[model samples]
Target: MSFLACRVFEKTESEKTESEKTSPKVQKTTIYHQLVQMETDELTAGDVLIRVDYSSINYKDALAASGRGKIMKQFPLNAGIDLAGVIVESDNDAYQAGDKVLVNGCGIGEQYDGGLAQYARVKSDWVIKIPEAYDTRQAMIIGTAGFTAALAIHRMQVNDQKPEMGPIVVTGASGGVGSIAVNLLSKLGYEVIALTSRKSMHDYLFELGANKVVSEDKLGMSDKPLGKALFGGAIDNIGGKTLSNIIAHTQLWGNVASIGLAQSPNLEAKVFPFILRGVSLLGISSTNCPMPLRTKLWHQFGKELPLPDFEAIVSKEIALEDVSPYFDELIDKKHHGRLIVNCQ
Candidate 1:
């Protein structure tokens, strides 16, 4: 080798030694705030660094992943809302290297580095040790969508809703949250009526345990503000006119949990249902849910909500690099079910 080349090699080795002696920080890069590249030293500082094994894309993830919605507060950010993995390093007393953990929402994939990459450095507070009955993949299969579904159900049940009270309607029934809600509600003995835009999903929704399947157009409002009472309660995933129609049709003293806005964000509804029939509109925000409740819900998911085949909800899986192509399909509401990401 030339003398200058040999000297450069020696200098590079010396620099590596120096870097090792002093822990170099993580340095992640972002392209258009959707695609993320994370190097060992690029991760943000935190009590623990996780080697993420899996993540899944939700509708919010589609928005951030496409750079179409202003959901991301910062640019050049990691953009997955859910992840499960093993801890590689820890500064907190509760966690150690190799401890399995999961993270969802809590401003991740938006205000902070998220789970799309193979590694993530996150606050100890944000970590939830994987429930005993669930592995990393199982946890990812449940993901944020399932977690939110469980939370919504728990809230309604706590408010005294019962299966015998009446049939429960789930809007956007083919999507992740709605599908899981249908399964869960049915498993718990509540009659489940699924609402979807596609008649094609009727059989699949039935297999997932939906007692009845109805089209969105069938739920359309009439000239009169209030329609004949149809459902006992509902899990309304489409927040706009569909929700309005659902509100108009709910039985007296029924409850509706508003979660997604696949159709639109506007809620064009009259107060007749709320005031006349004593219907309740329960707003569910799963992102900032308290840690205690989050842990409890995850435990319940592993126990009471276990699907016979978890992969049934996972309609597709893609490599980390291939995520962008699916964004258009998701944003246009062409995709059904959960899309898992394999970060390894």
Candidate 2:
């Protein structure tokens, strides 16, 4: 359907009373001002209904919200990819009312209505019980970006990455995934080098536990098939030549987990890094991650990779009314760190 035309209306007490009597089955209305109003019948199909407490902005969400990219396959769909909230209704045995749960990726804000509204209906299979250590807000603070970072680290560790090998580098270091990867990798005893185009965020990266911060310009591409091995392993958020450079410079037997294509999706690199150096370029997809692995990683995030200063990574917390402008800011690359949406 075309996006619901923008309009505003409020029910009078008499209208409310009359409507309640006329349609006892209708759910309460939720108005997301400047966006759209949603009710029970309007929600996308799902087995569980969540009272979304919080959702957070991601690059994809920015694209969808700002009408800049094909992030949303359906018009009028809710457009935040990460959500944490309490379950209010469920048709699945795995979850019940009052459970604190979260949904990330799985085509949310893309193929389905997502978490920007006060409530969302989502598949039970996509729902993860919030970790014991995290509150609703904290869960969204980590959101999809942090979760993807953790997934990248998990893949690297599975490939036998060790802290003693050498330093690990995180590209796009001021962004959500990069910042959390820096924090989590440092906490795991790895020397963390953060690379960013924004020189102003160097101190911010340091505060997030980066051992060093390097300018993106310093990581220039080379014609050589392999460059000097600078990082033992890397979590790359900006793809394209940045990713190729990381692969070229990764230590022998090291792995580089590529989690995004913010710079560009194209990769122009030789097979030397993989053939001669035994380097592995791993792809991370938090969206379609298998259920068992998704659950395990989230649990590990709570137990081992907890960000004690998660609030520090949140660049802003805005109400629904403020989302439109923030979308523009995000698409223009004018914002850094995570942006939390208070959907309550």
Candidate 3:
């Protein structure tokens, strides 16, 4: 069946019989096989059915949709890694029908059916209540990318990184995680230097609160184990040589949060930066982050961090049906900023 053939169904209280009122409601979801369609009775036990209002395309989502990376371990799985919506049916005491919630990573697109559809039945443990400050759209705008940035910042803060120390550099600053990191770190009073290969996005990055926008070429790789001490702290999204460069130039006792492997994953680095300069290389993993910490970071995004102009970061807003065409752009690295999927 065609994906567009999927239909949504909701039941009113009056429509339910006495026994059915307490029983979990069946939900029709846009499901994926070789094709897509609205399907019912797909939910397993202990799963909460969410009426997805919005979802966002991350690098992983793009990889999964295009079948480029080994992102989806299972075929015929729902695509899209991040979603925000309202709960329609719940088995968990922490949530109820009509509660706004969001789910990010936790192997959604990889290990289980994900959020590219009109509805999702996810494990209750993976569902986090959307903060009051954000609606479904805003939550998805932050999605996995913004959440990963916040997690990196939280780690840097724990390591005692302060604005007064020096500038915090964000490598791959035009991308989602890097963009959000630039905005968040700037808002927190750190001077942010955004590094991007796309020189065309310099003005855009500056508007997102980057104090300085530098070309990725400026971060020249060197054979020396220690380079000039430039950044006080860093949020590195591109790995390989870029990561090695960031490590070499970090100030004494500075922390560098390694969040992505957009570039090559291999790291050939000397131990001099670590043992001599006391630079700390922090590895950030958003996928399997503990629930308590995840909730806390989302709470911080809602209340503490100044919300960046999401419209500026949103490169495209397409419906679920139009998602396929954009995946190639994302995989090719031709798209900048975020791509939001309007599931509603």
Itemize residue pairs with steric clashes in candidate 1.
Answer: 25-41, 26-41, 26-42, 26-43, 27-41, 27-42, 28-42
Q: Estimate each model's TM-score.
A: 0.87, 0.88, 0.88
**Clash number by candidate, in order:** 7, 0, 0
lDDT accuracy of residue 114 in candidate 2: 82
- Across 191-291, the per-residue lDDT of candidate 1 in tens digits comes to 99998878888888898898889886665446456888888889988898878888888888888999988789999889999999988889988889998
Give, for candidate 2, the lowest lDDT window spanning 10 residues. 1-10
lDDT (0 to 1) per candidate = 0.79, 0.82, 0.81
Off by over 4 Å in 1: 1-37, 220-223, 304-309
Error of 2 at 167 (Å): 1.2
Residue lDDT tens for model 3, 197-233: 7879999899999999988667554657799888898
**Over the full model, what C-alpha lDDT does candidate 1 score relative to the true structure?**
0.79
